[model samples]
Target: MTGEVLWAPSAEGRQPHDRVVLVLDRGELRYRDQRKLQGIWVARGDDVGRIQGRQGPDALDIGAAELRDLLCRRRGELKPALMDQALVAGLGNLLVDEILWQARIDPRRAAASLTDAEHARLHRGLRRVLSVSVREGCVPQRPGWLTSVRARDDAACPRCGRSLERRQTGGRSSYACPHCQRPP
Candidate 1:
């Protein structure tokens, strides 16, 4: 809430049936996201509790064994598995791609198929990615990194300097380096 919003509408957006859910704690915060087809309903105390209950441990605290267990719980590709908050929280699409790329693991590989070495690399990558994200705030403090190229139209692998591959994974545009993160 302290940082300025880089991108947002000039004013609040609303349409028919759009109503402010609540000024949380009376004039604390309001539901201000742009409304489209479905109205965005703000969460109350109970709703917040339920949602947080579904969230797993933060990326920083999860041990290698715990991470391995979470990965094994899903038979799906690594991208989707990483995106699951119920497994381990705080991983988004960008973070997942960055983590896999940093760990030198293929995004399409099955989560259950990861070897012990791969898991170790993944754990390190997760910590590094989360640390960098928290520190730099997604502003790309330096060049030649995953987040730096992931959003570019002519993105290439920062480490290998090879053309990056982009494809659909779990309904999101997943990025990977063909040279660094070889496909299975």
Candidate 2:
């Protein structure tokens, strides 16, 4: 076969018995004691599957409509709204911090308080940050990127360097440039 052989215990063995079941091209082998298949070669092929884009953490596929709906009705804090897996999928704590920083929205701001312009900015920020993160795997901390602050507990804001403040939001420690993102 062109695919690898993945093995599972036979029904009898799974229940409680010494009988062994083996599957081979010749046919099924049933032995009261044990059965072993010889010359059973599994092949690895290059055409296994096609590459797909990164799906969010919950593995729920999200489209534009669902994203808009989730954002519109979300009544929690902005950080929590972004962190909800069912709402957008694939969003993690780092992504939320980066998105809020990029959009200049305070983590504590209410989701309903976001203006149309701010919402647009947030949408753009999410796409931009997630795309880059998925491409490189995790948030990339380039020299100018804000993710540098995430690495250091005492790391100051890259933009203001006024001692980044860490706060708990949605059960996660959120780091923000106090000067850049003010509480709304």
Candidate 3:
């Protein structure tokens, strides 16, 4: 999650940040990690399933009905439930925050308490945000997106222009618009 797998024309273009380099006939596939937080695993056949079995379905492929069911079965706050790799895969902190912001749902809300409409909104937001994020290969800090202003000294909600609130949710720093996302 903290590194990039890039394809270079040749090994000559490898950067100082590249941790591993694989020279192929066509090009060089390099893994670059400045922080060294990423790992490479070699799996074959059934071993692949063994690794994936520990996690939930990929976030992008999960259906709305499945998401609702998953949430209904979860405990604690929505943020933590969503961040749980076993509950929903492929979603990290930034994605959960952005999805909650887009859906106008409070991150601190009880996971199983979401209304039908809220569930729909959450699914829609997940799809919309993830489609764009997957295309960009990362969460883009666009001006209109909450990620753009979350770390600002005087951040304002991109939607309501209200002051953004910061708090610890599920052991991670979370940003939300007080006006847009009310308490559970």
Candidate 4:
């Protein structure tokens, strides 16, 4: 229940300046960057109860069943819905992209439109991608991995060697293998 708070100031025009405070309990993370006043809530501790962020309901001390029920009610885009920390916690853009690719689901797919099979795929993919990424501390780039091209403007698909396409999605650069993730 006792932990230390870490603070970092934002640079000019950086808004809240990448400040994250970790609340630790018994040497495990209980809360992370609880900057609700500044509209930032990174993650919550597994043992913590009822977490509140600046955006409200950022994460409640709820069980897995509650979290599943909440996810089922979202009708928004699948990526953003998964990224909503208030709903699932501990997922971001890189994770989302990697999950979708592993699940073979398009990023633009509507959450409600996904079939049960696709949902299963998404869940499995999310877990797998996150588990490995967390161990490695963020997605590491392999020579031919898609992530290698993620930040390269003219990078091509590693699988097919075709030019990768980029678009502004959810206010971030979205890199996709056009051939592999064709529109439905």
Candidate 5:
């Protein structure tokens, strides 16, 4: 996706430069805050396969079964496992936490060890969260959303009313409810 920022010139005011920020997950494109950036990532057959939701005939365009199969192939923790685009494309770190919390599945659980029912829950959660994100825009800032209460001093889980606990997962700070999302 392309992001264009409009700003007045230095002569007009002390405003930042107008620029286009192009961000590709995992693969770095240093436009937002970088001086120099270069990469040769062609969105061809092979590269399309690497990106999860690239509108190809791969995992992105497939149904829940394909998505489940893609995720189950990874043996890592759920957080990192979901974020790896090569495995299952569209989910980022925040989405990972959001999906896991919605599914009541612990982010620390092993991906390959999840029961069929748990997998079903995770899949349903993905559909619910992702579609809501697409429709409402920006991850849905409504009640029962972790992001809505994540930064508050008294952030609590919307589902169980328990305090939302912060923990490091895959080098990122993630918030979840311990009582709801017990480790599996």
Candidate 6:
């Protein structure tokens, strides 16, 4: 969440925040992290599998059935379960909140409490959100999207027009529309 990879026309264009810069034949690829939260680890062959074995299936690649099964196996609230990289990789607080909001699921609901249709909705939301985010190159703040107004003091649900609610879920801020995401 705190790291960025930027490309520059030349190595001389490196910024103060750039932690590493690869001088390519035509340009430079720079890794920048203001918080230094991400790191690089090199592994060879089987070692790579061993290193990544603890992480669950990637959010972008996991199938709907697999996601339902994974959630069903979790014993915690939905938000934390989704944020746990050991349970579902590639999802952070912001993405999980947005996904739940999109799925119209309550963040406080038990992880295993989703109905079959709810699971389907959740999976679809994940795919759609990630696809748009990947295309935009970031979690875009656009109209009709939760991210657009989530941080505003007077934010309202883009869909329902009801005031948005904010709370601390699993130690991270969560934004949801109370009218859309009713408590379980």
3 or 6: which has the higher TM-score? Answer: 6
Query: Tens digits of per-residue lDDT for model 1 on 1-184?
Result: 0122222233344333333433333333233333222334458878977767777887768999999998887888888888878778877777787889889999889989888889999999888888877786663425766778877899888898888998974456888888888754
Superposing every Cα of model 5 onto the true structure, what RMSD results? Answer: 6.6
Global Cα lDDT for candidate 6: 0.87
TM-score of model 4 relative to the true fold? 0.63
Off by over 4 Å in 1: 1-50, 139-141
Best by lDDT, which number? 3
Residue 94 lDDT (model 5): 70
Any idea how many clashes model 2 has? 2
Best by TM-score: 6
CA displacement after TM-score superposition, residue 89 of candidate 1 (Å)? 1.2
lDDT (10s digit) by residue, model 3, range 56-153: 99999999999999999988989989989999999988899999999999988999999999999999999999999999888889878998999898
The digit string of per-residue lDDT tens for model 5 on 1-184 reads 1222433322233223222333344332223322222243548776765643533233235577876776678788887777775566566667778888889998888877788888889888888888887666457667878877887888889888989889774456788899999966
Residue pair clashes in candidate 3: none
Q: How accurate is candidate 1 locally (lDDT)?
A: 0.73
* Residue-level lDDT tens digits of model 4 in 159-184: 78888777787477766677766545
User: How many residue pairs clash in each candidate at the backbone level?
Assistant: 0, 2, 0, 5, 1, 0
- Give me the runs in candidate 4 sitting further than 4 Å from their true place: 1-48, 52-72
RMSD of each: 5.0, 13.0, 2.9, 7.9, 6.6, 2.7
Alpha carbon lDDT of each predicted model: 0.73, 0.65, 0.89, 0.61, 0.69, 0.87
Give per-residue CA lDDT, model 2, range 17-105, as digits (tens). 32445766554454432232332233456432221212232313444445655667889777877776555666767888888888777
**Lowest summed lDDT window (length 10), candidate 6:** 33-42
Candidate 2 vs candidate 3, TM-score winner: 3
Which portions of model 5 miss their true places by more than 4 Å? Answer: 1-60, 169-171
Cα deviation of 97, candidate 3, in Å? 0.5
Least accurate stretch of 10 residues (summed lDDT) in model 5? 28-37
